[model samples]
Target: MNTDSTRRWLALGALAVAMLTIGLDMTVLTVALPTLAVDLNANNGALQWFSTSYTLALAAVMLPAGALGDRYGRKKILLAALVLFGVASLACAFAATAGQLIAARVVLGVAAAAMMPLSLAVLPVLFASPVERARATNIWITSTALGLPLGPILGGWLIDNFWWGSVFLINVPMVVLGAVAVAGLVPESRNPDLRPLDLPGTVLSVVGMLGVTYGFIRLGDEGWGNGLGWGALIAGAIVLMLFLGWQRRTAFPLIDLGLFASRGFRWGAVFAVLITFGLFGLFFTVPQYYQAVLGTDALGSGLRLLPMIGGLLVGSRLGDRLLPKLGARLMVAAGLVALALGLGLGALTSIGTEYWFTAVWIGLVGAGMGLGLPVSMAVAMDDLEVARAGMGSALLQALRQAAGTIAVALLGTVLATVYRSELGDLNVDPINDSVNSGVAVAKSTGEAGMLEHVQSAFVSGMGAMLWVCAAISAVAVALALWVLPRRSAAVGADEAVPAVFADVDAPESTHVG
Candidate 1:
C-alpha cells in the first residue's frame, strides 16, 4: 500500500477509537447502576437519570454540534471534543454523589455529540474510492457496535477488581490516544458556506426532550396518579410540536426537514430507531437480572453478556457480505426477524430459567441488532450530499439518541410497574423502589420467601419488557420490508452513484485538504 493509503486507514482507526468511547459510555452505566444505587444512595429515578441525562444531552446537542463542525473545521472540532470527553470522563470517575456523576455524564454527552457527526463527516473526506469507502464504513460501524456489549463486560470487570469509578477512568487512555492520533493524522475540512446556528430550535429540542423523558421516568417512579408526570408529558408533547412547526418556518433549521424526502433516509431512520429501542431495553434490564436476580457479581454479570457479543459479530459479518446481494430492504428485514425471534424467546424468561436458555435468546437479539443497525444507518447516510454530511449524520444520530432516551424511560416504566404489581402492595418503600432495594430488604429481614418473591417479581417485569421490545421489532420488520429500497443504486459511467459511494473512483484531489 502507498503511504497515503496507510495514513488514511490509520486515520480511520483513530476515528473508530473515538467512536468506541462514545458507544462504551452509552451502556457502561447499565452494570454500574446497581452499584450506584447502593454507593450513591440513588433511587430508581436517579438511576434512570444516570443513563438518560447523557443520552438526552446527546440528542439535544447533536444538531448544533454538526453545524459547528461544518461552520468550523471537522478535525479541530473533533479534537476539542476528544479532549473534553477525557476531562468529562475524569469528572465522572471522582463524582462524590449521584448528582455529580449525572452532571459529568451530561458533559460527556455534549462532547460526544460533536465527535459522532464530525468523525463520520471525515470518512468522505478521507476515502475517495466507493468500494474503499464502503469497506471503511463497515469497519467504523463495527467498532461502535463492539463497544455497546463490551461496555458491560469491561465495566463489570473494572468495578469488581477495583472500584465502580474505574469504569469511567478506563476511557481516559483511549481518549488520549484518539486525540493524539486525530491531531497528527486527520486533515481539517469545513463548509465554505456558513450555516447559521438555529438557537431557538436548539433550545426547544433540548427542553422538549428533557421534559418528555423526565415525565416518563417520573411516571415510572411515582405511578399514574402523579399529576406532575402527566402534566410534564403533555407539555413536552406540545413543545415538540411547536418545535417542528418552527423548523418548517425557520430559515436556518436545526434539522433539515427536506432530508425526509428521500425514501431511503426516512425508512432507514425508522428502522434504526426501532433497533435502538430494543437494544437499550436489553442493556438496561439484563445486567440487573444477572446481578440482582441471579446473585452474580458485577464481573459475572458482564461475562454473561458475551453470548450477545458473539452473535453480534457473526451477524455483522454476514450483513456486510450480504448487504450488496440482498439489498437494504431484505437485509434489514432478515435482521428484524432475528431480533423479534430473540426478543420473543426472551419474553419467556422466568426466575428459574436456565443460563443456557438466556444465552441463546440474547445471542439471537444481538445478531439481529448486528444485522440491521449498520445497513439502516448506511442507507440513511447514503442519501446525504457531501456538503451536508455533518448535519445529516448528526440528524440521524439525534433521532437514534432520542429514541434510546425514550426507550429506557418507557421500558423502565414497564419493568417497574410490572415488578410493583407482582409484589402486590408491598407497603415497603425500599422493596417497591427496585429489585436492588428489594433484595437488600430481603437480605436484611432474612426472609427466604421475601427473597423468592422479589426475584419472581423482577423476572416477571423483565419478561414484560422483553415482550414489548419483541413487538416493536416485529413491527419494524414489516415496515422495513414495505418501505426500504429493494436494491442499491447502480454505479456506472455517466450515472450518479449513491452519495455514500459517490466519487469512489475519483482522484485523490476530490478529498478535502
Candidate 2:
C-alpha cells in the first residue's frame, strides 16, 4: 500500500479508539449507579439525575457540535472534545456530592456530543474506497459494540475492588491515549462551502430536541402523567415543528432538510432508530432480570450479557460481507426478520426459563442488531457529500439517541405498569416501585413465596416489554421492504468515485494545521 493509504488506516485506528471510549462511557455508568447511590448518599432522584443529565446534555448539543466541526475542523473539535472528556472524567472521579457528579456528567455529555458525530464523519474522508470504507465501518461498529459489553464487566470489577469513583477514573488514561493518537494520526478536514452559522435555527433545534428527550426520560422516571413530562413533551413537539419551518426559510439552516429527499438517507435513519430501539429495550430490561430474578451480582450479570455481544460480533461480520451481494433492501429486511424472531422468542421468557434458552434468543437479538444497525448506518453515510457529512451524521445520531430514549422510556413504563398490576395491592409502596425493592421486601419479611411471586411478576413484565420490542422489529421489517433500495445497481455504480465524497474530488488544503 502507498504511504498515504497506510496513514489513513492508522488514522482510522485512532478514530476507532475514540469511538470505543465513548461507547464504553455510555453504558458503564449503569453498573456503577447503585454503588454511587450508596457512596454518595444520593437519593433515588439524584441517582436518576446522574444518568439523565448526561443523556440530556448529549442530545442537546449534537447538531451544534456537528456544525462546529464542519465549519472549523473535525479533527480539532474531536481533539478538544477528548481533552474535555478526560478532564470531566477526572472531575467525576473526585465529585463529593450527587449534584457535583451530575454536573460532571453533563460536561462529559457535551464532550461526547462533539466526539460522536465527527468520529463517524471523518471515515469517508479517510477511506475513499467504498469497499475499504465498509470494512472500516465494520471495525468501527465493532469497536463501539465492544464497549457496551466491556463497560459492565470493567465497571463491575472496579466497583468490586475499589471505590465507586474508580469507574470514572478508569476513563482518564484511555482518553489521554486516544487524544494523543488522534492528534498524531487523524487529518483535519472540514467543509469549505458551509454557510455562516444559523443562530436562531441552532437555538430552536437544541431546545426542541432537549425538551422532547427530557420529557421522554422524565416519563420513564416519573410517569406519563407527570406535569413536567407532559409539558416538556408538548413544548418540544411544537418547537420542533417550528424548527422545521425555520429550517425551510432560514438563510443558512442548521441542517439541510433536503438530505432527507434521498430515500436511502431517510430509510437508513429509520433503520438506525429501529435497530437501537430494540437493543436499548434489552439493555434496559435484561440486567435487572439477572440481578433481581436470577440472584446474580453485577459482575455475573455483565458476564451473562456476553452471549449477546458475541452474537452481535458474528452477525456484523456476516452483514458486512452480505450487504454487497444482497443490497440494502434484502439484507436489511432479512436482518429485521431475524431481529423480530429473536425478540419474539424473548417475549416468551418466564421465571422458569433456562439460561441457555435465554442466551440463545438474546444472542439472536444481538446477531440481528449486528446485521442491521451497521449496514443502516453505512446506507445513511453513503448518501452524504463530504461537505455535509458532519450535519448528516449528527442528524442520524440525534435521531438515534432520541429513539433510544423513547424506546427505553416506553419499555420502562410497560415494565412498571405490568409489574405493579401483577403485585396487586401488596400495599407495600416499596414493593410496588421496583423489582429490587420487591426482592428486598421479600427477604426482609422472610417470605420465600413473596420472593417467588415478585420474580414471576417481574418476568411477566419483562415478557411484555420484549413483545413490544418484537412488534417494533416487525414494523421495521415492513419499513425496510417499503423504503430501502431493491437493487444494488442503484448505489453500487457510484461506490468508488472520488467525487462521491466531495473532499476527495477537491484539492487538499495546503494550510491544514
Candidate 3:
C-alpha cells in the first residue's frame, strides 16, 4: 500500500477511538444514576435533571457546531472539542452537588455535540472509493456502537471497586489519546466557499430543540397530563416550523434542505431514526429489568447485557458481507425483520422467564441494530457532497439524537402508565411513582405481597413496551422495502474508479494543516 493510504487508515483509527468516548458517555451514566442519587443526596427530580441537561445541550449545539466546522476547519474544531470534553469530564468527576454535576454534564454534552458530526464529516475527505468508505464507515460506527453496551459493564465495574467519580474520570485518558492521535494523523478540511453563519436560524433551532427535548423529558417524568410539558411541546413545534420557513428563505442556511431531495438521504435518515427509537427503548427498559426484577447489582446487570453485544457483532459482520450483493433495500429489510422478531419474542417475557430466553431475544435485537444502523448511515452519507459533509452529517445526528430522547420518554411513559394501572390504588404514593420506588418501599416496610405486586407490575409494563417496539420495527421493515433505493450510489460509482487510487487527490481536496 502507498504511504497516503496508510495515513488515511491511521486517521480513521484515531477518529474511531475519539468516537468511542462519545459513545461511552451516552450510556455510562445509566449505571451510575442510582449511585449518584445516594452519594449526592439527590431526589428523583435531580436524578432526571442529570441526564436531561446533557440531552438538551447536545440537541441544541449540534446544528451550529456543524456549520462552524464547515466554515472553519473540521480537524481543528474536533481537537478543540476533544480537549473541552476532557475538561468537562474532570469537572463532572469532582462535582460537589446535584446542580454542579448537571452543569458539568451540559458542558460535556456541548463538547460531544461538536465531536460527533465533525468526526463523521472527515470520512469523505479521507476515502473517495465507495468500497473503502463503506469499510471505514463500518469501523467508525462499530467503535461508537460497542461503547453503548460497554458503558454499563465498565461503569458498573468502576462503581463497584471505585468511587462514582471514576466513571467520569475514565474519560480523561481516552480523550488525551484520541486528541493526540487526531492532531498527528487527520488532515484539516473545510468548505472552501466559507458561507456566512445563519444567526437567526441558529437561535430558532437551538430554542426549538431545547423546548421539544425538555418537554418530552418532563412529560415522561410527570405523566402525559403535565401542563408545562404540553406548553413546551406546542411552543417548540411552532418554533421549529418557523426555523424551517427561515431556512427556505435564507440565502445561507444552516442546513442544506436540498440534500433531502435525494431519495437515498431521506429514506436512509428515516430508517436510521426508526432503528434508534427501538434501540434506545431496549436500553431504557432492560437495565431496570436486570436490576429491579432479577435482583442483581449494577455489575451483574451490565454483565447480563453481553449477549446483545455478541449478537451485534454477528449482525455487523453479516451486513458488511451482504450489503454488496443484496443491496441496501433487501439487507435493511432483513435487518428490520430480525429486529421485530426479537422484540416480538421479548414481549413474551414474564416474572418467571429464564435468563437464557432473555439473552436470545436481546441478542437478536442487537444483531438487528448492527445490520440496519451502519447501512442506513452509509446510504444517507453517500448522497452528501464533500463541501456539505459537516452540515449534512450534523443534520442526521441531530435527528437521531432527537429520536433517542423521544424513545426514552415515550417508552418510559408506556412502562410507567402500565405499571401504575396494574398496581391499582396503592395508597403508597412512592409505590405508584415507579417500580424502583415501589421495590424500595416494599423492602423497607417488609410489606407482604407488595414486592410480588411491584415485580409483576413491572414485567407486565415491560412486555407492553416491547410489543410497541416490535410494531415500530415492523413498520420500518415495510418502509425499507417500499422507499429505500435498490442499491447504494457508492456501489454504482465504484464501477468506474480503480480501487488503488481511490484515496488519491480528486478535483476537490482538503487543505492539509
Candidate 4:
C-alpha cells in the first residue's frame, strides 16, 4: 500500500478497537448483573448502582476529557484510556464483592469516556474527502452499533457457559491489540488554540447529571414516594441551571455553549438522549422477560434479541441514505415517531407471549434506534468546524451516556414500583424465603400465595415500566421538533474552527501545541 492508504487503513483499524471496547463494555455487564447481585449478596438497589456508577462517572468525565484531547493529543489520550480501561476490566473480573465491582466499573467508565467521542472525532481527521469521510463514518457507526447490541449476546453465552468475569476478561485481548495498533499507526494531533479547561462548567454539569441519575436509580429501589428520590431529581435540575450559567461565563467552556445554537447540534443531542432512553432501557428489561419468565438461558435470551440488532442495522443504513437528502430534521423526527410506536407496542407484551411475535416488535424498536442514533450524530457533527470537532463529539457522547444512565436507573425504579404494586404490596421476607428454601416446600408450606403474588407483581410492574418508556419516547418527538430545527450553525465556522480540523478541500495541515 502507498503511504497515505497505509496510514488511513491503520487508523481505521485502531479506531475499530476503540469502538469495540466501548460497545462491549455497555451491555456486557448488564447480563452479569443478576449474577453479581446473587454472588455479592447485594440488593436490587445496589445492583442498580453498579450500572449507574459507571454511567455517571463516564458522563461526568466525557466533556472534560474531550477538551483534554483537543488541548493535548488524541493519540496520547486514546492510548492512555485503553490502558486504564484494560486494567479496570481486569479488576472488575476479579472483584469478589459488589462494592469492589462497582468501584471497578466506575474506573472503567472514566477510562471509556475518552474512547467513544475521541474515536468518532478521529474519523474525520483520518479521511480526506467528504465522500471518504462519510464512508469511514458509516463503517465506524456500523461496527460500533453492531458491537454494542451484541455485548448482551456475547455476555449471555459467556456467562451461561463460563463465568461472570469472563465478560470483562474478553476486553483484554482487544485492548492489547488496540493499544499496539493505536501506538504504532495513529499520529499525534491536537487543536493548537484549545482554551483552558472549563472547570466550573464541568463541575456543574457533573453534579447536575449525578443528581438526576441518582434520583432515577433511587426510584428503582425506593420509588418516587421517597423524599430523597424526588429531592435528587429536583437537585439535578437545579445544578443544570448552575452549569448553564457557568458555561456562559467561561471564556473557554468545556462545551462550546455556542454549538447548541446549531439546529443540528441541539436536535441531535435531543435525539441522542431520547434514542438511548428507548433502546438501552428496552434492552435492560428484555433479558428478564426471557430468562425470568420464558425460562430461557442467557445465550437464548440474547440470541432472541437478534431481530432487534438486525433492525438496528437496517435503520442505520436507511438513516444514512436519507441524511444528505432530508437533512437532519425530518429524519430524526421520523425516527423518534417510529421508536415511540415500537415502545408503545412493546409495553403490551406479557409472559408466555409467543417468542416469534416478540421478535417483530423488538425489530421495530431496533429500527427506530438504528435510524435515530447515527442520523442525529451525523447531523450534530455535520456543521462542526475542523477545530471544534473533538469538543462537539465529546458533548454528544456525554449526552448519549447521560441519557443511557438515566434511562436504566429511572426505568429500573419504575419497574420495581410497578412490580410491588401489582403484588398488592410485597415484602422481601417471602421472596427471600421461597426462592431460597425451595419452591415445592414454599407451595406446600403456605408461601405459595405470597410467592405467586410477588411474581405477578413483578410482571405487572415491568409492564408499567414499559409504558413509561413509551411515554418518554413519545415526548421525544416533541423535543426533536422543538430542539432540532433545519438550520446551519448559529455561530458560523470562522471563530469556532480550530487549526486542526481544516476542511478536506483545503491543503492538508497538522497542528501542534
TM-score for each of the candidates: 0.89, 0.84, 0.85, 0.84
lDDT by residue for model 2 (1-513), tens: 233877887778877777777777777777665456456765334545666567666766767777788789988998999999999999999999988998999999889878777777777777778789777766666566567778888877887788878888888887887888788877778878675878888788778866776676566556567999889888998998999999999887877799898777788888878888787778767877887777777777778888887877677677666777888788778878888999999889888788898899989988887777666766777776766555566667667766765666567767766776687756266676567767777999998999989888889888998998899889889888887776444344223221111100111111111
Q: In order, what is each prediction's RMSD in angstroms?
A: 4.7, 5.3, 5.2, 5.8
Q: Model 3 over residues 1-513: C-alpha lDDT tens digits?
A: 223988889889988888888778877877776667567866444555676677667766777776688788998998999999999999999999988998999999899888877787788778878789878866776687667778889988998899989999989999898899889888888877677889999899888876776677667657789999889988988999999999999998877789898777888788888887777778767877887788877788788888887887788777777778888898789889999999999999987899999999999998887778767876777777776554555677677776776676667777877887788766357676566777777888898588888888988989999999999999889889998888774743222121111110111122211
lDDT of 1 by residue, 138-203 (tens): 677657756766888889889989989999998999989999998888888887878688999998
Candidate 1 vs candidate 3: the TM-score winner is 1
Report how far residue 115 has shifted in candidate 4, in Å.
2.1
Per-candidate clashes come to: 2, 0, 0, 7
- Candidate 3, which segments miss by more than 4 Å at Cα? 1-16, 37-52, 96-99, 119-142, 180-190, 383-390, 489-513
Model 3's TM-score against the true structure: 0.85
Off by over 4 Å in 4: 1-4, 120-136, 320-330, 378-390, 429-452, 475-513
Off by over 4 Å in 1: 1-13, 123-142, 184-187, 321-327, 381-390, 489-513
User: What's the ranking of the predictions by lDDT, best on top?
Assistant: 1, 3, 2, 4
What lDDT does candidate 4 reach at residue 202? 79
**Which model is ahead, 2 or 4, in terms of TM-score?**
4
- Predicted candidate 4, C-alpha RMSD: 5.8
| Ten contiguous residues minimizing lDDT sum, candidate 2 | 498-507
- Higher-lDDT candidate of 1 and 4: 1
Candidate 4 lDDT, tens digit per residue, 1-513? 223877788778777766776777767766666566556766656767777788888888876776777788878998899999999999989989878988999999888777765665566567758788766765665456456667888999999999889999998888888899888877777777767887788788888988887787676666577889789989999999988888788777766688788766776667677777776667667776666556677778778888887887677677656665665566677777888888877777765478876898888888887666656666677667767565576667667777777777878777766665564434444343212122222445687565455545556666787788778778877777676655333322221111111100111111222
Among these predictions, the greatest TM-score belongs to: 1
The Cα local distance difference test for each model comes to 0.81, 0.73, 0.77, 0.69
